[model samples]
Target: MNPGASYQTELAQKLQCFFSDQQQGLDIPPAQLYRIEGFIEAGLLAGFITELGLKQTLVDSAKQYLNVEVADFYQQDYRLILHMRMHEAPVYPSSNPPCPQS
Candidate 1:
Protein backbone atom coordinates (compact mmCIF):
# COMPACT_ATOMS: atom_id res chain seq x y z
CA MET A 1 0.00 0.00 0.00
CA ASN A 2 1.17 3.54 -0.70
CA PRO A 3 2.38 5.35 2.39
CA GLY A 4 0.17 8.35 1.67
CA ALA A 5 -2.98 6.29 1.20
CA SER A 6 -4.06 6.90 4.78
CA TYR A 7 -3.65 10.63 4.43
CA GLN A 8 -5.63 10.61 1.21
CA THR A 9 -8.43 8.63 2.82
CA GLU A 10 -8.56 10.98 5.76
CA LEU A 11 -8.72 14.01 3.51
CA ALA A 12 -11.52 12.42 1.49
CA GLN A 13 -13.51 11.72 4.64
CA LYS A 14 -13.05 15.25 5.83
CA LEU A 15 -14.14 16.68 2.50
CA GLN A 16 -17.26 14.50 2.43
CA CYS A 17 -18.13 15.29 6.04
CA PHE A 18 -17.65 18.97 5.52
CA PHE A 19 -19.69 18.98 2.34
CA SER A 20 -22.45 16.95 3.93
CA ASP A 21 -22.70 19.29 6.90
CA GLN A 22 -22.92 22.34 4.65
CA GLN A 23 -25.41 20.64 2.40
CA GLN A 24 -27.64 19.99 5.37
CA GLY A 25 -27.48 23.51 6.80
CA LEU A 26 -27.81 25.49 3.56
CA ASP A 27 -31.24 26.56 2.27
CA ILE A 28 -30.74 27.49 -1.36
CA PRO A 29 -33.22 26.66 -4.10
CA PRO A 30 -32.86 23.49 -6.12
CA ALA A 31 -32.48 25.41 -9.37
CA GLN A 32 -29.39 27.20 -8.07
CA LEU A 33 -27.86 24.25 -6.33
CA TYR A 34 -25.79 23.09 -9.29
CA ARG A 35 -24.16 26.48 -9.75
CA ILE A 36 -23.60 27.01 -6.05
CA GLU A 37 -22.01 23.55 -5.76
CA GLY A 38 -18.79 24.62 -7.47
CA PHE A 39 -17.92 27.22 -4.84
CA ILE A 40 -17.84 24.59 -2.12
CA GLU A 41 -14.32 23.53 -3.04
CA ALA A 42 -12.85 26.86 -1.97
CA GLY A 43 -14.42 26.56 1.49
CA LEU A 44 -13.39 22.91 1.71
CA LEU A 45 -9.79 23.72 0.84
CA ALA A 46 -9.70 26.49 3.44
CA GLY A 47 -11.13 24.18 6.07
CA PHE A 48 -8.63 21.44 5.24
CA ILE A 49 -5.74 23.87 5.41
CA THR A 50 -6.93 25.11 8.81
CA GLU A 51 -7.30 21.55 10.08
CA LEU A 52 -3.70 20.87 9.03
CA GLY A 53 -2.42 23.66 11.32
CA LEU A 54 -1.37 26.23 8.69
CA LYS A 55 -0.83 29.75 10.06
CA GLN A 56 -3.93 31.95 10.03
CA THR A 57 -2.29 34.76 8.04
CA LEU A 58 -1.03 32.36 5.40
CA VAL A 59 -4.38 30.59 5.28
CA ASP A 60 -6.36 33.81 4.93
CA SER A 61 -4.02 35.17 2.23
CA ALA A 62 -4.06 31.96 0.24
CA LYS A 63 -7.85 31.57 0.50
CA GLN A 64 -8.38 35.16 -0.63
CA TYR A 65 -6.20 34.52 -3.66
CA LEU A 66 -7.61 31.09 -4.43
CA ASN A 67 -11.23 32.22 -4.31
CA VAL A 68 -10.80 35.31 -6.42
CA GLU A 69 -13.63 34.16 -8.69
CA VAL A 70 -16.05 34.19 -5.75
CA ALA A 71 -14.64 37.52 -4.68
CA ASP A 72 -15.11 39.00 -8.16
CA PHE A 73 -18.65 37.64 -8.40
CA TYR A 74 -19.44 39.24 -5.05
CA GLN A 75 -17.65 42.54 -5.93
CA GLN A 76 -14.91 42.12 -3.33
CA ASP A 77 -11.43 43.68 -3.17
CA TYR A 78 -9.61 40.58 -4.37
CA ARG A 79 -10.98 41.26 -7.85
CA LEU A 80 -8.76 44.33 -8.08
CA ILE A 81 -5.75 42.37 -6.85
CA LEU A 82 -6.50 39.63 -9.37
CA HIS A 83 -6.71 42.14 -12.18
CA MET A 84 -3.43 43.74 -11.10
CA ARG A 85 -1.73 40.36 -10.96
CA MET A 86 -2.99 39.46 -14.43
CA HIS A 87 -1.88 42.68 -16.12
CA GLU A 88 1.15 42.27 -18.39
CA ALA A 89 2.43 45.82 -17.93
CA PRO A 90 5.06 46.36 -15.23
CA VAL A 91 3.37 49.55 -14.18
CA TYR A 92 -0.35 50.20 -13.90
CA PRO A 93 -1.65 51.39 -17.27
CA SER A 94 -4.19 54.14 -17.79
CA SER A 95 -6.82 54.27 -20.57
CA ASN A 96 -4.04 55.42 -22.91
CA PRO A 97 -0.90 53.35 -23.27
CA PRO A 98 2.22 54.60 -21.50
CA CYS A 99 4.33 57.02 -23.62
CA PRO A 100 7.83 55.77 -24.45
CA GLN A 101 10.61 57.36 -22.31
CA SER A 102 13.22 59.43 -24.17
Candidate 2:
Protein backbone atom coordinates (compact mmCIF):
# COMPACT_ATOMS: atom_id res chain seq x y z
CA MET A 1 0.00 0.00 0.00
CA ASN A 2 1.01 3.55 -0.48
CA PRO A 3 2.56 4.95 2.65
CA GLY A 4 -0.04 7.69 3.07
CA ALA A 5 -2.97 5.33 2.62
CA SER A 6 -1.40 2.84 5.00
CA TYR A 7 -0.95 5.49 7.65
CA GLN A 8 -4.55 6.64 7.30
CA THR A 9 -5.88 3.11 7.48
CA GLU A 10 -3.84 2.42 10.58
CA LEU A 11 -5.12 5.57 12.21
CA ALA A 12 -8.74 4.74 11.39
CA GLN A 13 -8.29 1.23 12.73
CA LYS A 14 -6.82 2.59 15.93
CA LEU A 15 -9.80 4.89 16.42
CA GLN A 16 -12.17 2.04 15.73
CA CYS A 17 -10.45 -0.19 18.27
CA PHE A 18 -10.34 2.54 20.87
CA PHE A 19 -14.06 3.20 20.64
CA SER A 20 -14.88 -0.45 20.53
CA ASP A 21 -12.90 -1.20 23.71
CA GLN A 22 -14.29 1.87 25.46
CA GLN A 23 -17.95 1.38 24.65
CA GLN A 24 -18.32 -2.25 25.48
CA GLY A 25 -21.68 -1.99 27.21
CA LEU A 26 -23.06 1.26 25.87
CA ASP A 27 -24.54 1.88 22.43
CA ILE A 28 -21.85 3.51 20.26
CA PRO A 29 -23.35 4.10 16.87
CA PRO A 30 -21.77 4.73 13.49
CA ALA A 31 -22.45 8.48 13.65
CA GLN A 32 -20.49 8.85 16.86
CA LEU A 33 -17.73 6.75 15.43
CA TYR A 34 -17.59 8.99 12.38
CA ARG A 35 -17.40 12.16 14.46
CA ILE A 36 -14.61 10.74 16.56
CA GLU A 37 -12.90 9.52 13.44
CA GLY A 38 -13.09 12.98 11.92
CA PHE A 39 -11.36 14.52 14.89
CA ILE A 40 -8.70 11.83 14.93
CA GLU A 41 -8.16 12.08 11.18
CA ALA A 42 -7.64 15.82 11.40
CA GLY A 43 -5.18 15.42 14.24
CA LEU A 44 -3.35 12.69 12.40
CA LEU A 45 -3.11 14.76 9.25
CA ALA A 46 -1.77 17.76 11.13
CA GLY A 47 0.72 15.66 13.03
CA PHE A 48 1.89 13.84 9.90
CA ILE A 49 2.12 17.06 7.95
CA THR A 50 4.17 18.62 10.69
CA GLU A 51 6.44 15.64 10.89
CA LEU A 52 6.86 15.52 7.12
CA GLY A 53 7.88 19.18 6.96
CA LEU A 54 5.02 20.75 4.99
CA LYS A 55 5.38 24.20 6.40
CA GLN A 56 5.06 26.02 3.10
CA THR A 57 1.82 24.32 2.20
CA LEU A 58 0.51 24.86 5.69
CA VAL A 59 1.51 28.51 5.66
CA ASP A 60 0.10 29.10 2.20
CA SER A 61 -3.17 27.49 3.09
CA ALA A 62 -3.36 29.55 6.25
CA LYS A 63 -2.76 32.69 4.25
CA GLN A 64 -5.55 31.87 1.83
CA TYR A 65 -7.97 31.06 4.61
CA LEU A 66 -7.13 34.08 6.74
CA ASN A 67 -6.87 36.49 3.74
CA VAL A 68 -3.37 37.59 4.64
CA GLU A 69 -0.01 37.79 2.98
CA VAL A 70 2.46 35.00 3.58
CA ALA A 71 4.71 37.23 5.62
CA ASP A 72 1.92 38.55 7.81
CA PHE A 73 0.50 35.10 8.19
CA TYR A 74 3.83 33.97 9.60
CA GLN A 75 4.79 37.05 11.58
CA GLN A 76 3.44 35.75 14.86
CA ASP A 77 4.17 32.10 14.21
CA TYR A 78 7.80 31.98 13.19
CA ARG A 79 8.32 29.02 15.45
CA LEU A 80 6.44 26.86 12.94
CA ILE A 81 9.86 26.35 11.40
CA LEU A 82 11.20 24.84 14.59
CA HIS A 83 7.97 22.98 15.15
CA MET A 84 7.98 21.33 11.71
CA ARG A 85 11.68 20.57 11.94
CA MET A 86 13.19 20.11 15.37
CA HIS A 87 10.15 19.21 17.46
CA GLU A 88 8.23 17.30 14.79
CA ALA A 89 10.11 14.04 15.10
CA PRO A 90 7.96 11.09 14.13
CA VAL A 91 6.73 8.80 16.90
CA TYR A 92 5.82 5.20 16.23
CA PRO A 93 3.16 3.78 18.51
CA SER A 94 3.78 0.11 19.08
CA SER A 95 2.01 -2.33 21.38
CA ASN A 96 4.93 -4.74 21.43
CA PRO A 97 7.67 -4.42 24.01
CA PRO A 98 10.49 -2.18 22.91
CA CYS A 99 13.74 -3.81 21.91
CA PRO A 100 16.83 -3.24 24.00
CA GLN A 101 18.67 -0.06 23.11
CA SER A 102 22.23 -0.81 22.16
Candidate 3:
Protein backbone atom coordinates (compact mmCIF):
# COMPACT_ATOMS: atom_id res chain seq x y z
CA MET A 1 0.00 0.00 0.00
CA ASN A 2 1.05 3.58 -0.60
CA PRO A 3 2.35 5.50 2.41
CA GLY A 4 0.16 8.50 1.63
CA ALA A 5 -2.93 6.28 1.42
CA SER A 6 -2.51 5.07 4.99
CA TYR A 7 -1.79 8.59 6.28
CA GLN A 8 -4.82 10.06 4.49
CA THR A 9 -7.16 7.31 5.69
CA GLU A 10 -5.98 7.70 9.29
CA LEU A 11 -6.33 11.47 9.21
CA ALA A 12 -9.82 11.30 7.70
CA GLN A 13 -11.00 8.80 10.28
CA LYS A 14 -9.62 10.90 13.13
CA LEU A 15 -11.27 14.07 11.83
CA GLN A 16 -14.59 12.29 11.31
CA CYS A 17 -14.50 11.05 14.90
CA PHE A 18 -13.72 14.52 16.17
CA PHE A 19 -16.61 16.00 14.21
CA SER A 20 -18.95 13.23 15.34
CA ASP A 21 -18.20 14.07 18.95
CA GLN A 22 -18.85 17.74 18.26
CA GLN A 23 -22.14 16.83 16.65
CA GLN A 24 -23.19 14.94 19.76
CA GLY A 25 -22.56 18.01 21.91
CA LEU A 26 -24.51 20.32 19.65
CA ASP A 27 -28.26 20.96 20.02
CA ILE A 28 -28.91 21.74 16.38
CA PRO A 29 -32.27 20.85 14.83
CA PRO A 30 -32.74 17.88 12.50
CA ALA A 31 -32.74 20.21 9.50
CA GLN A 32 -29.30 21.47 10.43
CA LEU A 33 -27.80 18.02 10.94
CA TYR A 34 -27.21 17.64 7.20
CA ARG A 35 -25.27 20.87 7.12
CA ILE A 36 -23.06 19.72 9.97
CA GLU A 37 -22.47 16.44 8.21
CA GLY A 38 -21.52 18.25 5.01
CA PHE A 39 -19.11 20.44 6.90
CA ILE A 40 -17.53 17.43 8.59
CA GLU A 41 -17.14 15.57 5.32
CA ALA A 42 -15.60 18.58 3.59
CA GLY A 43 -13.17 19.09 6.45
CA LEU A 44 -12.17 15.45 6.25
CA LEU A 45 -11.58 15.75 2.50
CA ALA A 46 -9.48 18.90 2.76
CA GLY A 47 -7.50 17.44 5.64
CA PHE A 48 -6.91 14.27 3.73
CA ILE A 49 -5.67 16.20 0.73
CA THR A 50 -3.26 18.19 2.87
CA GLU A 51 -1.98 15.10 4.64
CA LEU A 52 -1.32 13.37 1.34
CA GLY A 53 1.13 16.08 0.28
CA LEU A 54 0.37 15.45 -3.36
CA LYS A 55 0.56 19.14 -4.07
CA GLN A 56 4.08 19.32 -2.72
CA THR A 57 5.05 16.36 -4.79
CA LEU A 58 3.61 17.97 -7.89
CA VAL A 59 5.48 21.19 -7.22
CA ASP A 60 8.73 19.36 -6.59
CA SER A 61 8.36 17.39 -9.78
CA ALA A 62 7.74 20.49 -11.85
CA LYS A 63 10.39 22.70 -10.36
CA GLN A 64 12.35 22.85 -13.62
CA TYR A 65 9.47 23.63 -15.96
CA LEU A 66 7.89 25.96 -13.44
CA ASN A 67 11.20 27.74 -12.80
CA VAL A 68 10.57 27.66 -9.08
CA GLU A 69 12.86 26.68 -6.24
CA VAL A 70 11.89 24.46 -3.31
CA ALA A 71 11.98 27.38 -0.91
CA ASP A 72 9.78 29.44 -3.20
CA PHE A 73 7.40 26.55 -3.69
CA TYR A 74 6.68 26.52 0.04
CA GLN A 75 5.46 30.11 -0.27
CA GLN A 76 2.53 29.10 -2.47
CA ASP A 77 -0.79 27.56 -1.49
CA TYR A 78 -0.13 23.95 -2.53
CA ARG A 79 -3.52 22.74 -1.37
CA LEU A 80 -5.22 24.96 -3.94
CA ILE A 81 -2.72 23.78 -6.55
CA LEU A 82 -3.66 20.18 -5.89
CA HIS A 83 -7.35 21.05 -6.04
CA MET A 84 -6.88 22.60 -9.46
CA ARG A 85 -4.88 19.62 -10.67
CA MET A 86 -7.62 17.26 -9.52
CA HIS A 87 -10.27 19.40 -11.14
CA GLU A 88 -8.42 19.37 -14.47
CA ALA A 89 -8.12 15.59 -14.63
CA PRO A 90 -9.76 14.00 -17.63
CA VAL A 91 -13.26 12.57 -17.32
CA TYR A 92 -14.05 9.61 -19.55
CA PRO A 93 -17.48 8.89 -20.96
CA SER A 94 -19.38 6.09 -19.22
CA SER A 95 -21.52 4.76 -22.08
CA ASN A 96 -20.09 1.76 -23.99
CA PRO A 97 -16.75 2.37 -22.40
CA PRO A 98 -13.80 0.02 -22.91
CA CYS A 99 -13.22 -2.52 -20.14
CA PRO A 100 -10.97 -5.47 -19.54
CA GLN A 101 -12.46 -8.84 -20.40
CA SER A 102 -13.39 -11.02 -17.43
lDDT of 2 by residue, 73-98 (tens): 45557544311111234688999998
Each candidate: RMSD: 15.4, 16.7, 16.5
Off by over 4 Å in 3: 26-102
Error of 3 at 84 (Å): 29
lDDT of 1 by residue, 1-102 (tens): 553455445544543443343334543344444433333334345453332232232234334544445334435332111111221325754798778999
Q: Output the number of the lDDT-best candidate.
A: 2
Question: Considering only N, C-alpha and C atoms within 3 Å, which residue pairs clash in candidate 3?
Answer: none
lDDT of each: 0.38, 0.47, 0.44
Per-residue C-alpha lDDT of model 3 across residues 34-65, encoded as one tens digit per residue: 55446435545755454335445445443532
The CA-based lDDT of model 3 is what? Answer: 0.44
- Which window of ten consecutive residues has the lowest lDDT sum in model 2? 80-89
Please report the TM-score between candidate 1 and the true structure: 0.26
Ranking by TM-score: 3, 2, 1
Better of 1 and 3 by TM-score: 3
Clashing pairs in 1: none
